[model samples]
Target: MFTGIVQERGEVVALDLAPDGADARVTVRGPLVTQDVQHGESIAVSGVCLTVVASHEDTFTADVMAETLLRTSAKEWAPGRAVNLERSVTPTTRLGGHVVQGHVDGIGTIVARVPHDGYDEFSISVGKDLARYIASKGAVAVDGISLTVIDVNDSPTGAVFTLGIIPETRTATTLGGAAVGSSVNIEVDVMAKYVERLLSFRDVEKA
Candidate 1:
């Protein structure tokens, strides 16, 4: 588990894709997260929970399965791409952000960006299926950085949400350089999903 607090911005050092396109191996250089990381430990890389398969110096390697590739922006990752990195939280860790499972629900695209004096507001579009899990003032993890949804708008086909990005977030995470067309991994509040599941049983009982 994680608290959606980004520890560092890491860079992909190498990416080796299998010939069959079934899976791929990636090596990321994250000095802070790799300092005490061990094999088999979990690390949230761009909101995807990946296990450390190997570690060397300041770099650690993890395997990306086909399912993760299809569900996240990992397929677009290449050498030199910057990514948000966060180490799994311990029992004593503070929940600075919110409960983040590192399980990306889907990929969202930045549709617009508005600059402010001390901050910026970005509008991202996601499929309605995923948008149903998001709400205004609620928490969402974008590329492993927890952000509060400023607003939400629904369209016929999809939905868009606005997020206020302070200067600290811009400099501390990869969102600093994200362009309008860039893609990001999004993880909605896990509690919302659990509540929906529990409500489904209530509906069944009503029938």
Candidate 2:
């Protein structure tokens, strides 16, 4: 579990994919997150929960399975790419953001960006499967950074949701350099999914 608070903007040192591309090993240089990290510790790298297999100096390595590659922007990761890094929350950790499992629900594409007085609003398009869990003023984790949804618009193909990003968030995370059409890992609020699941059981009982 995580709080969706990015502690470091790490850089991808290397990525070695298997010949069959079924899985891959990625090494990231995160001085802060690696300071006390140990083997088997969970880290949210760009919103994907990865286990540390090896920790050396300021870098750590983790394995990415095919399922992660299919559902996240990890498939496009390469050397020098910046990634958001957040260690798992401890019992005493402050809930600065919300409950973020670091389990990316799906990939979203940045479709539009508009500048505001002191912030920027970004519109992202997501599949209906993922958008169904999104609502205005609700929370969503984008690349491991928790953000509030400003609005949501349903479309024929999917849905486009807007977010307000402050200067602080833009300068501290990978999203600072995200451009239109860029792919990002998105994790909708876990509570919404749980609520939907619970309601389904009620419907079954009513029938």
Candidate 3:
């Protein structure tokens, strides 16, 4: 489990596709983070739960399968690109952010970014596929960073939600550099997903 609190911004050092055509190696350099990660430690990389295959003081390598790559934004990473990094929560750690699985629910695109000098409010496109889980003032993870949904509305294609970004958020992760039309990996609240699953099961039982 992760708290969604971003620890540091990491630079993509390497990204090589594995031979299986379903897995790839993702290496990142983050030195301020020294938590003694094991070979199988769970690491949240831009909202994706990647198991560590190799780890060191300043770098760690994780294998991401094609399913993970397609489900999240890891495939969009290139050498020198920036990404949000966070270690899994420990017993002694504080719950700074909400429960985040690092599992991308679906992909969304930035529809508009409205700047008000100090901060910006961004509206993005969320479709029916992802809209059911979204609630006003609820938590949403975009590119691995936790954010609150400001508003929501339905469209012909899907639902559209607006998110308010503070200056700190704009400077912390890739969201700061995101532009309109940019694809963002989204992970909705875990509780919302579970509730939906329960509802589906109930429907099946009734049928």
Question: What lDDT, from 0 to 1, does candidate 2 have?
Answer: 0.95
lDDT of 1 by residue, 70-108 (tens): 999999989999999999999999999999999999999
Off by over 4 Å in 1: none
Clashes of each: 0, 0, 1
- What is the overall TM-score of model 2 with all chains considered together? 0.98
- In the range 1-207, model 2's lDDT, one tens digit per residue, is 999989999999998999999889999999999999999999999999999999999999999999998899999999999999999999999999999998999999999999999999999999989979999999999999999999999987889999999999999998889999999999999989999999999999999
Per-residue lDDT of candidate 3, residues 1-207 (tens digit): 888778888888999987765778989887755467788888888888888889878899988888998887788888998888888888999988888888899999999999987789999897889998889999999888888899998877789999999899888888889999998889999999889899999999999
lDDT for residue 38 in candidate 2, whole number 0-100: 91
RMSD of 3: 1.5
Error of 1 at 69 (Å): 0.3
Q: What TM-score would you give candidate 1 relative to the actual structure?
A: 0.98
Per-model root-mean-square deviation over C-alphas: 0.8, 0.9, 1.5
| TM-score of each candidate structure, all chains considered together | 0.98, 0.98, 0.94
The 10 consecutive residues of candidate 2 with the worst lDDT sum are: 149-158
Select the stronger candidate by lDDT from 2 and 3: 2
